[model samples]
Target: MNTSGGAAAAGRAGNSDALEHLARVGLIALGIVHLLIAWLALQLAWGGGSGSADQSGAMATLAEQPLGKPLLWVLTVGLLALAVWQLAELTRKVPGLRSTGEERKKAVTGTVKTVAKVVVYVFLAITAFRFASGGGQSSSGQEQQTVAGVFAWPGGRFLVGIAALVLIGVGVYHVHKGVTKRFMKEIDAAQTSAGERRTIERLGQVGYPAKGVALAVVGGLLGWAAVTFDAAKASGLDGALRTLLEAPFGKALLTLVALGIAAFGVFAFFRARYPERT
Candidate 1:
């Protein structure tokens, strides 16, 4: 028996536990970010101050508060932990992956979801770090620049179109999850009260579709960018919300969506409180 192997296993277990703890805290940080974004979006909806309503903008707002820098550091660490946790989940084998066809399909879908989360969390972690270090930029500007760079490449339009389609699919999935109360699968129902379940369900019903609408608009903008060969049309979340203002009864729509987003942020707090261990 190699004592060294046992020591390494113990070390790995300790690290995993630390990462799990961080991931739990990260969920709370994520909720705070969403709540900030919701506030900015509401300001726009109600004809108030001018501020970008996106993740980067949220980070910037956080930076303006007391102890903001230290908070950024904590957010950065938490997000990084979340990214690592998702990556680990993505790579881990699914239970009964080889047992049945339905199980195999579920495993594949779960893997894809985990992979997407890993990408999102990593991007968010980078954004958090940038704000923490006082080196943040407008998310809208960054999106346009990235789209422009993509267009400069050969066959870029088609690639952008494909990306738009992917976004739409993701949006639809969120809507479906919300409408179907599928998100409850991630909650430890056995540990929750009936009232809590009802509250979560109600929140999911409103919040998920709101997120879906936002993503759908973002995808549409990307599609416009692809079709017109104009990278400027491909804006981020802030751009999407502004575009909403250009339509009929836009303010009302934006306000509704903003409320839904705020609800999602509140739901995220519930998630932090009642996470389902894998």
Candidate 2:
């Protein structure tokens, strides 16, 4: 054992309880955002004047409400705190991966996941800031522009192809994770009642696959972009959601997925309630 590393980990552990609660609040905020998205999706399903039904759209809708700026500011702070919490987690040692190879592999994978989470939270924080400041832009438009710009570069097609493949893989992983109930491993058994665990599991069974389907749709769009060399085809979440609108029985499908996403939001609440701080 490295003494310095051990000491650092111990110091982090001492503060984990407090930070964990803060992270829980952040998770709640995340759930709220997803719930809003689900509502927008429902409206779209009913041919109502729903906005984009993605994260930016969600942010835009929030900005239109009373005291929206203050709410966004609060969300930003919570998200930042969550990012910091993940940072602390990235530094701490894994408890159960005792074998050298297992530990190394687990550490690397964990770090990557934590880092990805940090990026996501930070991006959301920035998005909130943008919306609060009245400078929000269309996420799909930006995504298309970004993809177009990427295609301008040498080997950009290859890069875009790689990204598409990665997203596809991630989508598959999420579906598999949901099917296998692997996410339950993150729950603190001591903190969760049997009923609560069952509820969380059931919600996750629907939620994860719904999210996976959305991701897979987005990946297919990106793949289409690569194949046709048309960056406009590589629209983000908004495009994927809208694409569902064009399909046969689209409204019903969209509504079902929206509810699944809402279930995910509720699942996040349970996760916040019974987090296993590793």
Candidate 3:
């Protein structure tokens, strides 16, 4: 009986570890998908037309494209999945309140992060659906209509700008908590070696800057568009790139920015593959 019990316990332990590993992999995959979407959004925001010969304006150009609709749906589902995975990880890591006050504080932080993640995912889904449904006015017919008629309502740009700000704030708070609270220590404890610690730290560092830059660029563009009531002028990614290119030093700067964003995606890919040994 004792021997049988030990074997069962070991099996359960192995299964639990595998589940955690799978959850981590899922989270990483979701992150990569998001980064890819960001890159595509950036490419479109730049001077690259949707590769279509249509007379459609910029919005229509993006909407009518084959990749646009699929990308939108992919992002929507991926973000929701990410949110769920994050919450699950938090629950697994902190199944209950610890006796120590510090542990309790960490639990609170995790809860806040989970909530923030849910909000971001919800808004992202809405944005994706709006884009996919042709409600965003990116089609040729919508483009031919008055720009005022489409952009005047302050729907797309305004909501996205607000969501970006919230995401940035949440990301910053999480990073701060991670560093100050030494949350990575928990991860390190689960890891086997010092090298794993270094790897996880590097991933965290890269993630921080990427999230910050994305938030700032998207948020700033939306805010500017909302105030100026210029939907065409306020579009994300492309508009920002266009503004940069129009400046005397804009082209060079835009190139560097694009490369930096792409590099982030590359970094994400690496992190996802190797991940932290935890």
Candidate 4:
């Protein structure tokens, strides 16, 4: 009749090979989204047409495909599964993590990232569901509207500033992960052949920084909006990329970023194939 023991048993029961497989499918869905985003970014670089280059944009692109609705359903299922897997990790213990100083710090950091992953997967999954159910719409400039909504709340400016800092911090961590090759730990290095490992490493080195830099820019804009009391300035990912396109030498830079995003998408496929870290 021990409630805690029963809860622990239930948590363990949620861990299964089927769940892991579904999680891998989520990674695949993630890769597809990123690849589509990359393609959208490239279009922005070359044509500068008015289109969203964020997750919503990616989902929109999927909706236009021949089997788009079905694909969206698949993507939704995969992302939801991945989110569940990551959420379950919140209550589970790391295999080798101990209660020591460095180990403890690593544990905390890993938990934070896992939580971020869960949020990301759930968001993407919900977006997919919306599109699948014919409720999706173009998300351009919604970030500004969302921020404006927050501005109506009491002390909302402070919350926006804090959110900006979190985005920047996560962005920096991604850059650090890429530059230090720490992203390798996110996968099973032992499972791949030498060539495959090298390919993944190369992809991570480029991809993580590209993603990190983009997130940092988004955060920087949010921070600016908080300071100016102008929600229009905080346009989120779509705006950040568009801002780059408006800058001097921006086309070249955006193209590089787009390529890097594509690299990340490819790396995600390999991650799906391995998924040991998941």
Q: Which candidate comes out best when scored by lDDT? A: 4
Query: What are the RMSD figures for all models against the true structure?
Result: 3.4, 2.9, 9.3, 2.2
lDDT of 1 by residue, 142-211 (tens): 8889999999889988999999999989889889999999988867778889999999899889999998
Q: Report the C-alpha lDDT of model 3 over 1-278, residue by residue, as the tens digit.
A: 68546545544543465544554454443454344444444554465535211111332344566787776555556555545545555544454455457777777766776677666556555555666676754332232133345454557545545654664475465456434634354352343367765665555555545444544554565556556666553444444445555657765655555444454444444444454443
Q: Report lDDT (CA) for all predictions.
A: 0.85, 0.82, 0.50, 0.88
lDDT of 2: 0.82
Could you give candidate 2's per-residue lDDT for residues 1-278 as a string of tens digits? 69668658755853667767777877887887888888888888888855788888888889889998888888877777788877777556454233478777887788777787899898988998898888987585888889999999999998999889878877887788789998787678678788888898998888888888788888989989999999888988778878987899898899888998898889888878887755
Off by over 4 Å in 2: 1-14, 93-100
Q: Give per-model TM-scores.
A: 0.91, 0.90, 0.49, 0.93
Lowest lDDT 10-residue stretch of candidate 2 = 90-99
Please tell me which model should have the higher TM-score, number 1 or number 2.
1
- Output the better candidate (1/3) by lDDT: 1
Summed backbone clashes in each candidate are: 0, 0, 3, 0
Model 1 TM-score (2 dp): 0.91
Q: 45, model 4: CA deviation in Å? A: 0.4
> Model 4: which residue pairs collide?
none
Worst 10 residues of 1 by lDDT: 90-99
